[model samples]
Target: MSEAERVPVEVAVGVLVERDAAGREGRFLLTSRPPDKVYAGYWEYPGGKVEAGETVEQALARELREELGIEIGPAHPWQTLVMDYPHARVRLNFCKVFDWTGDFQMLEGQQMAWADLPVQVKPVLPGTIPVLQWFAAERGHSGPTHLD
Candidate 1:
């Protein structure tokens, strides 16, 4: 099927950002793709696809719990992007998550990191680059967002 006719997979992505006492956004979370998945070792926000009957918020909450072992609070809808990758086309629905309870477990055998602008992680996933750029824009950050 042609690109126009192909339906993009709807994914719910959680941008888990830390906030200070004054409510200023700070470092967000990133997770390395599990070893067996496509683009493995590339860092990206924590999330997964929206299931057949789930809304973006439901999917985000469920995915984060399963992937990171944390029960998220409200997932404030942030941004959406359509990305066409070699493996699949996806519509990423990013939500700014500020409140959550529980320690992260990295349930899928992936590594997780809390990162800020000019992210210290390497080999970021292509699907994740735009989210970093969005964070940079919102924070008035200038420079390469992450290492290749």
Candidate 2:
């Protein structure tokens, strides 16, 4: 394929991090993707593409800051999904962000909902079920990259 004939595909990473408030563990946050966008009305983790000249962590932090208005600290790499959409194929590199500087909120106009393990989350997105199962298997207060 010629360079001009080839179109660039977008690579985005959606992070699924858990937090514990009070004595309850396995608290995860989910946000709905805008209806106007590609994956409209679908619930997903708040993250975006790995931009040029930026690492995965850097891109994840940048995207989270823009999406949730929170500064994430150490994040553990999780599952990766390569799906083919009608327009393009996206490489979703999921991560678990446990440590951060500030509190998390919906910076964008998207809706945010918090869920606990096993019962709180649902298979909203097609690719999210596997990740959710992985999260459910490893319910703990401590943070670790659990991708089974």
Candidate 3:
């Protein structure tokens, strides 16, 4: 394909579920990509690609149930970001999930973590970096760049 040819962008949804710690800062959930998937072992918000005829919300709900074994509640549409990666271009639709039902489970056998700003997790997915920066900015912290 020519450089000028437009690359098709995959529409993906991301769920940001934050947990408020008593008398401390809140933390958001991040899951490790399955070993067989692209960017294996990279941490990211819980979500998946939007299927045909599915709205962003619908996709989020389905993904959460399948991946985390929870029914999402009160998810607020947050941000839309388009990022280019060597593997694929994607348009990410992010949602801020305030509530959910059921105990969190790593259904896909991936590691999960509740991370605070300036995430201590190494090698987060490139598409997720901007979202983390935004989250940090919301918490009054300077966003770190890829080099940080």
Candidate 4:
């Protein structure tokens, strides 16, 4: 199908789980995509596609458990964005999670990091770049401004 006729594959949800650091800016989680996945090695907030009959929160919880081995608590809906990649168009629903259980583990052999703004990870997924900018703005930092 042509680009105009193509439908987005699915709506995906992600969680930014924060770690409050005393006397320092708090950090949020970012995960590297598995080598086998499209956009492999790119960093993004942990989440997965919302399945049939599942709410975004449900998907976030499930994905975190399966991918990171953590059970999420008190996830607050934050922002939503629609992006079109070469592989598929997607709607990303990002949530800010303030609480959770279990030690964070990379169950999928993916790298994990707790990052502050201006993340050190190289090559973040294009769709996630905007989220990072939004995060910076929310933290009272100046994000990029575009001139059209």
Which numbered prediction scores highest in TM-score against the true structure? 1
Please write out the lDDT profile of model 1 over residues 1-148, one tens digit for every residue.
Answer: 8877779999999999999999999989999999999999989998999999999999999999999999999999999999988889999999999999999999999999999878888889888899888888988888988886
Which sequence of candidate numbers ranks them by TM-score, best first? 1, 4, 3, 2
Which pairs, if any, clash in model 2?
none
Provide backbone clash counts, one per model.
0, 0, 0, 0
* Model 1, position 139: C-alpha lDDT score: 88
With a 3 Å backbone cut-off (N, CA, C), the pairs that clash in candidate 3 are none
Q: What is candidate 4's CA lDDT for residue 133?
A: 79
**TM-scores for candidates 1 onward, in order:** 0.97, 0.73, 0.86, 0.87
Looking at model 4, how many pairs of residues clash?
0
The number of clashing residue pairs in model 2 is 0
2 or 3: which has the higher TM-score? Answer: 3
Better model by TM-score, 1 or 2? 1
Score residue 12 of candidate 4 by CA lDDT.
48
**Ten residues in sequence with the least summed lDDT for candidate 3:** 1-10
Better by lDDT, candidate 3 or 2: 3
Better of 2 and 4 by lDDT: 4
Please provide, for model 4 over 34-115, each residue's C-alpha lDDT reduced to its tens digit, 9 standing for 90 to 100: 9989989988888889899988888889999999898988668888887888888788888888888898889998998877
